[model samples]
Target chain A: MPEPMGFFTDTTVCIGCKACEVACKEWNQLPAENGGIRELSGDSYDNTRRLDGIHWRHVRFIEQFKGPYDGRWLMMSDVCKHCVQAGCLEVCPTGAIIRTEFDTVVIQSDVCNGCRACIAACPFGVIDINPVSGTAQKCTLCYDRLKVGLEPACSKACPTDSIQFGSIVELRTRAQKRVDQLKSQGVKAELYGADPNGALGGLNSFYLLVDQPEVYGLPRNPQLPTRNLAKSSSFSLASAAVLGVLALVGLRKRRMDDMGGPGAGGSN
Target chain B: MSDTFFSGAPHWAWLIILYFFVGGIAGGACFLAAVVDWFGGPEDRPVVRTGYSVAAWGAILSGALLTIDLGRPLRFWHMLFQSANVPALMFKGWSPISFGAWAILVFGLFAVLSALGGMAEEGRLHNPALRAVGGAVRGGLAKVVGGVAGLLGVFIAGYTGILLSVTNRPIWADSPWLGALFVASGASTGAAALILLAPGRGATEQSLARLSAFDTKALVVELLVLVLFVASLGSVNRVWIGFWGLVLLVGVVGLGIVAPLRLHLQRRPLASAAKLVLLGGFLLRVATILASEGIERYRVAAGM
Candidate 1:
């Protein structure tokens, strides 16, 4: 397997230019959203709403303006985390989704029956059905590019150096240093999904956020779907056991009723 | 997009919901047939036969509904075999859908065999060779096949709920009682279905009374489990407090459980009660699935 590669997106440096989104669509041959017809959302300049099947990379424009220029407009370029413990890969019944040699997850389109089990299992809400393909799809973290020793299109197109792509080890070191620098400047900067010991086993594509994770539509603590499986199955077993005993008791009661009464066998 | 950040529900609409209902009956009927064949009197043969027939046909319908629900129906076989690698069957124990696919296939085999055996016992098979095979299934080997199939049936009934519970969907993942609730409901619905179908097949008044007795107990258990399932949801229970909750309370609880129990106690017609029970079972699945889907939509609309 190749060295584990990933993306470290620093929201502080992101210009919200949407260059990464355009680069991803162009390189991936992804169809334009709503047939390329742009509509003013009135929320901000962000017409492209969220990351989905067609929109692999989305630039969120969070307008936190008080009066005029008091508060800051936070911008975060969201993409698939390519989580170390991917819920989508885990719940896929067809084995269509696989972890690539680069340690990034990829869905084999030809094999996907589009059951959409992965979509519900995903805590990140990353996977969705591609209308044209009729199969669940999301960012592959540029699996095609990584195969030939190339960086991902989104990262390559990012002119601000906000979206850094490199070996996981090197990126973590750089991210920590940046976090320290920002903290010294009192920016309240922190790294999300950088710790390898975290709940989702840490994400390959992590983020550097200035505020709470929820402000950017990210879960504070995402979990795998299988976390509740054992408990659910246990309760099911107990219920089945109770029902079995009830069946035997019902049968016993019927025999007694038949033996004692004169018109017991007559149907109602 | 939603407040939960979920892109959308899995698009598991009517087809999947129908499968859950049919699959429950198939599993429950097979289990009842096995129990009757093993423990009940010989006079219960008609009930056993009807149970096996329901199990056989219900299993087939369940399989069909599941396959047709897939986005690519032609690739339904991918659930069993790994399409990326030919000839090698795929099995993931951690994945409920993987385990469920295999369970359905195996349970279908047993259900069909039992139904054929019951048919042969009634002298329905014309061919001597086919009759002989059916006789073997119904003869000494009957207990073995029914026993295994009964257990698998229970698994199928409960596994469907477990399938929903292991998702990020709001109400689905919030509580562990979905599987328990489904199992109880499966029993009640299974008994109701047999009660409806048994009389036409020459079921004895004694056998019908026995089934009615069983159905009553199952309904009580179902009612109890339904309460526990809702109560366990905590704040997630808010998602079902409106129209969906009303359906669950009135349609499922009052009409489905209470009405059926009242009719049975008052010595009213069993068929009417059975029909109501079946309706209630379908409504339960509808309420659970749509409410979760609606919650996801509500979250997105509310915005973070």
Candidate 2:
């Protein structure tokens, strides 16, 4: 049908104003944590710690300051990656998590039994249980808004245009250009989850980061759950075979012991 | 970012853990029953019946526990069928849970059939029609049904560990030995269960003793596999540094594996050893699941 759409987050220019997060919550009708009560995280200006069930968008504030001036602050708005080969979608037994026509992963709350398979499967720590819906919840990349030709609320509210949403192809070209521009300006700019051939088959919602992926709570080499499937199953089968042989050995040994002493199996 | 938690907890809690425990035993017991039915003499029928009985009930309980643990328990059928596309079977070869759900379901079917056969052979079924069904299963079809059930049982016993290993969790994904370890533990616990329950149902002392011997070996194998599993974790094995570690050491290793071994060697009552093994099996699931879920809590406590 239609071309796939996604987000290209330029973290280098994020102001950490959290306008995008507020807009996302407002548009999604998501409730505030602890019933609108506020608590300090003691980490930075960020109180919303990370993306979870309620918070579809999290603005992470990282301070790499020696005297608050020598180093720089790295602010990132983290959300679900919506990978091309999404771990959550791959492991969702209920078929609740589906890839929309936009190629963005969305969890169908009605269909989700909330078994939490997606929670364990997601490498980026994106999916979590919503207390209200009692289902695994995460960013849908504003599927409703996209269906109506409107942009996602978070990107729409991003005054600095840090979180840009558009067709995947156009976004990739723009991201590469931005990376080149930043590199020319003496910045160590790198594109994460942008290459179609890369990890998780390249995240539909990718990012441009100045630091290592781990520095942004992202995996350097994120793997699908299938990576361990064959090895684990093979080892399990071997163990089963050993158990079977030992069981037979136990039976034969007992038979021999009985035959040596009284009578074979007591003959009762 | 390194300070942050890498993933969300499944909140599997007690229900899923209990399911793992019972599901393992069900699969193990079914396989053990198949072994006895094929190898043991006519006198060992009681033990085989006991195995089938345990398998059937264990599979049923595992299913119930898994269903109740879901967010929408009524929608548990969604696991087996695509609710969006009615009547379309939901099966994901790549998803362990999907495979597990189908395996448990199919295994339950086989377990129930075998148990029915055992019951009819024991002359417990009164209805003529039911007896005929059970008699046919027990007579001509017993070997084939038992073989298939036993194979599926082994899969069921080990797949839970594989399920964990396939996840992004710290200690779970770190090891490939969980499946082996879980299977070994399942065998031991299943044997222990039969040893405890088979008596007075007509199990001979010889058969019981042989099962005990098998259980002892299974415990040793489980112990070795567990060591490898923990070792495979490398520094991530530190997840067992606190309360969970104590459970693993005292409950799983000392009481579950070692004490039972000691009892078996001393020729003490099989019941005593069996109880200890059962307790250990339960605790193993608890320690493995909760420890990973509480990894973040432990990390903070250790100043990590």
Candidate 3:
């Protein structure tokens, strides 16, 4: 309702410094994800692998060698999409999850029963339960900072302009212009989750990617799990109704059989 | 496209699986009792009484399992709180889990009342005051309560699957028939429980033979729904193929269904079939949960 503030991440200019990661952890006062010891994952220089209860923002380093001379490193900063039709918010058994004024999803930790419904409901696998707190955790888009007119820590700490934060309309315009500029220079730039009509009703935080969405571990077409509930509930309700009717009918047949039997002074 | 991203499986563990199995059995047992009350006369009172007690006890056990699954066990009351629409108490209440909470509570209460009515019918209650209460329940209220509990029982059985279907995970959302399948299995297992408690050789054989006739039909329907559920996933490029799959195919479909049919046709003993169906009922929940393993975060494996 308040202009729908969000982030538009352009991976082309990302430096993959992970300064945003450190800044997020520091600002949020999050504890170590794996007991504080840093390990260089054999995957790449990206040690902090994926977003979990602790890591809300992750910098991914993708290395490719099309042919020794035709190689490039694809760097992307991944964060919660803050989807318009958030599955987590929809499936939350305790109304602990809420969609904020800025259209970002936030979990009220105190109210959460830690049923883990939201964790499974998340399409992007964004939410997780912080072991210590025993409540689901995910990117709130810096709800505390946004309340006081401050940008998210990750976007503020980004070295390059890869992560841009502002009103949804303004960011969409800027991202489209950047995509056009790159295409003119023979770069295959496409905006993912920018179209409001797209699956999941688009994202408050979207991306500009150089390759297929799968290359970045994003769903080609993310869907709201709630959309499937209609079919499931309907089929089930029908089955229950049909079974209940047949069961009742069976009861009637038994009554008639009893009445018509030899004990009732009738033929068996 | 070749990039890999690992996603952790859902947070549910053994307790939730236990809840599903226990709740399914309870729901099924109550449904059978409701059927007998609606149609059968005094002759079926013994089996009907067992159904009532089993449903009541099953509801209590499953309720305990649900409570144990919660992280803040003391904060369980938080589920019943409706912060946004308190004024609409009749229409609007808690979330889905909250609705389930009240549903189970009501079902359990009715089941207990139904059992009391049975006690009165059999002249089992001793104290005059307790006998009076049982008398009132047996007169008419017990039928209404059993009928209401039956509806709630069916709801509880299917809603478990609906609860899982609401998750974005593919293994859950893949099939719209999970609830239908679960209910059918619930009914079959409930019948098996009754069979296991059959009185003696002569009466037991007749009762089991009739139940087997009904249960085998339920099993056939359950099998058909299982196929429909798996077929629904065909377009998604996912298949149930693993240790759990074998358990479902062999343990549930084979032993639970085929063995029961064989014994029922031969008029032979069905104690083994009863055990197999009960075990299969629980294993079915296990198979359903395992189907979701590595469903997400394995984006890299499928080339996303």
In order, what fnat does every candidate score?
A: 0.65, 0.71, 0.46
lDDT for each residue of candidate 1 in A90-194, tens digit (9 for 90 to 100): 989999999999999999999999899998888777788888888888999899999999999999999999999999989999999999999999889999999
- For model 3, the DockQ equals 0.46
- Residue B231 local lDDT, model 1: 86
What TM-score would you report for chain A in candidate 3? 0.90
Error of 2 at B166 (Å): 1.5
lDDT of 3 at A185: 100
Q: Individual DockQ of the candidates?
A: 0.57, 0.55, 0.46
> DockQ of candidate 2?
0.55
Query: Model 2, range A1-268, lDDT digits (tens) per residue?
Result: 9898999999999999999999999999998788888798665687887778899999887777788559988989988998999889888999999999999999999999989998888888888888888888999999999999999999999999999999999999999999999999999999999999999889989999999877777777888877889999899999999999987766665567656855444321
Number of the top DockQ candidate: 1
Residues B24-90, candidate 1: write the lDDT tens digits: 9888888888888887888999888888889889889998998888878899899999887878998
Q: What share of the true interface contacts does candidate 2 keep?
A: 0.71
The segments of candidate 1 whose C-alpha lies over 4 angstroms from its true place after superposition are A37-44, A66-69, A255-268, B1-7, B126-132, B297-304
Candidate 1 vs candidate 2: the DockQ winner is: 1
Candidate 2, which segments miss by more than 4 Å at Cα? Answer: A68-71, A253-268, B1-5, B127-132, B296-304
Give candidate 3 regions above 4 Å deviation: A38-40, A249-253, A260-268, B1-8, B83-98, B120-135, B198-205, B235-239, B296-304
